[model samples]
Target: MSATTLPIPTDAGDLPGLLWLPEDRDEPVPGLVVLQEIFGLSEYVQQRCADLAALGCAVLAPQLFARLDPPVAGIEDGDDVEAWLAEGMELTSRLPWERAEADAIAALGALRAHGAVDQERVGLLGFCYGGGLAVAAAASAEEEDRPPSALISYYGSALPTLLERAARVEVPSLHHFGTADAFIPSQTVEEIREAVTAGGTREQVRFELHEGAGHAFDNPHPALHHAAASEAAWRLTAGFLAETLFPRS
Candidate 1:
């Protein structure tokens, strides 16, 4: 696994970012932005970058919390997720959410300048808070300048509140949710569907609900993660990215 740390410049602030590339690959590759969960860019998020690198995609993960507080390096899902999150909020709360969104966009520009990325074929994938941002960022882009060919969101619970904007998402999208997500109730799912439909982006939205799962179902910890749901979502995400970003000519 080969990786490096880079910086992103935005109007709000400068942010640190991580880039992972497969070993012995000298050719330009499609880029994929791996947004972190609210816990910050912990080890799991870095590991996901390596995982995507193994798939031959150049992966970049921006440390959105850098301006507020540099988060811990490795944190797995468990009872402690909230504790780590509290630490993160201390720094993040200092930075306006609007700024973070701008930083997310800036990270893409930085990645494009690295010379190893296919600018026209970028993709964005995020989990938890990042998941909702992934949808919003992709949707917010104008068709002629969109950064992502595909968007993947895992348990994008906050989206319902921002549905007015999220509903504008027109890129081909794959969304995974736990049927039992306490964060996003079943009734809310129906409402989200209505919003997506209202946006007229229904053809671009593909929603899937996993049975016997809950929030953060994709985390690896058995106590906090649902193995079946995690694995299932991974498969769907893989297929979606392959189809959208690495499609056959």
Candidate 2:
């Protein structure tokens, strides 16, 4: 499904977002707020949103980089992996963490309030930088008593710092990480697993570690994409979202 421009209302102002709905929509459907990676809402991110919509979800992806001075809508991948990584990191550094977190929460609210979305069935999904932001947003939303039904994060780069609030995020959640991720070490991933899953006591939380996968394994870039891991992770994600967000009776 193709995505259309959506303006999300926030305290600062309306942020530009992209919304994708299932083509066979006959009634209100479950909603998902997809946060962007450090590279912003690039083509890969939009394709993922389309994938979710194809699964019968009302998907909304907020353009977090739009808040920047130049308002970058997306970043193109280049041959130089190191340079591209540095550029993405620089862009993310320019945006304040607090602002991005609040914007993510606002996007969730906007998605929940969408005409085609069933408010109670709304969830959060994120990748890379956004993966960590989803965790923070879920925690904040829970504190406000507006928790999303489900949460999914793929290689959340900021998770190491957000562990303190993990307890507040009590919703059903699925976390994906690479065992070989250089950006986030294996030890750190284990720590994240411990925090988010409450030392394996939270039966509702599912954490998957993909072996032989590095950071951004799902990205289509030659340097980052791990085809096997990406396919496996997507399979797990689809199943998780199916059972948690839009289960059939």
Candidate 3:
């Protein structure tokens, strides 16, 4: 469980990122680029990265909020979610979506280039805002023949805006959403499902809906967390990543 700050070179500039490597690493392992939620790389995100490492992965999380004049890495659980949301929206408002998209791709490049990773087996896992960005990154990668091996998106807030591109996501992917998500209603979820699976390869793209869970239900914060749904989603994510990125050889 070694965590260190690493610089990731992107077209935009050098982006500060957190790198987590599993201990007792005697060999290269699959890698993952974890995109942050609206709150940035908060403790919950770091914990998620550590969880992935425990499952045998090298994880890199780019600090997207670094583009701000005074970088905002993450917010504490005690911080007001509404205030943080407002601040996050303002921060992203200042940054262009294209630049954010580029930074995400660069994150994949960084993971691929890292000596401890099996370049061919890197995946992208994004939550909330990042989930949408992940779709864009994965789409661009597929277009360039450097697509992620797998993608896991959890209630991507920008899914609607990125649907046109997300529909083009051609990798083994899994999407998790709460049927009761206020931000993205169930209706939109159905639309997303239709668009992404329009090509008739349903087996390759899967979507799971938790009956009454809300957005960010996996967050440990009591207000946003749904214990049962979170546990089920985690189990599904772990199995999905394993089956897609590290198939039995």
The candidate maximizing lDDT is 2
Model 3 spans with C-alpha error above 4 angstroms: none
Model 1 misplacement above 4 A: 24-26, 69-92, 197-201
List, residue by residue over 1-249, the lDDT tens digit for candidate 1. Answer: 857988777776567788897675767787888888876777777888898888878898988766654444434455676675576455555667676667777777777777887787788888888888777777656433755777888887568887887677667888888888888898887777667656444776788889989988886655458988888888888887788878487
Q: What lDDT does the true structure give each of the candidates?
A: 0.76, 0.93, 0.89
Candidate 2 collision pairs? none
lDDT of 2 at 4: 94
Q: Alpha-carbon error at 129 in model 3, in Å?
A: 0.3
Task: Compute the lDDT of residue 245 as modeled in candidate 1.
Answer: 79
| lDDT assessment of candidate 1 | 0.76
lDDT string for model 2 (1-249, tens) is: 789999999999999999999999888999999999989999999999999999899999999999999999989998998899899999999999999999999999898888999999999999999999999999999999999999999999999999989766889999999888988988889999999999999999999999999999999999999999999999999999899888588
Better of 2 and 3 by TM-score: 2
Query: What is the per-residue lDDT of model 3 for residues 1-249, given as tens digits with 9 covering 90 to 100?
Result: 667988999876799999999786777899999999887899999999999999989999999988887878886675677776687677778778888889999999998999999998999999998998999999999999999999999998899877799988878999999988998988889888887776556679989998889999998888789998999999999999889887487
For residue 14, model 2's alpha carbon misses the true position, in angstroms, by 0.7
Please list all clashing residue pairs in model 1, or write none if there are none: none
- Evaluate model 1: give its TM-score: 0.89
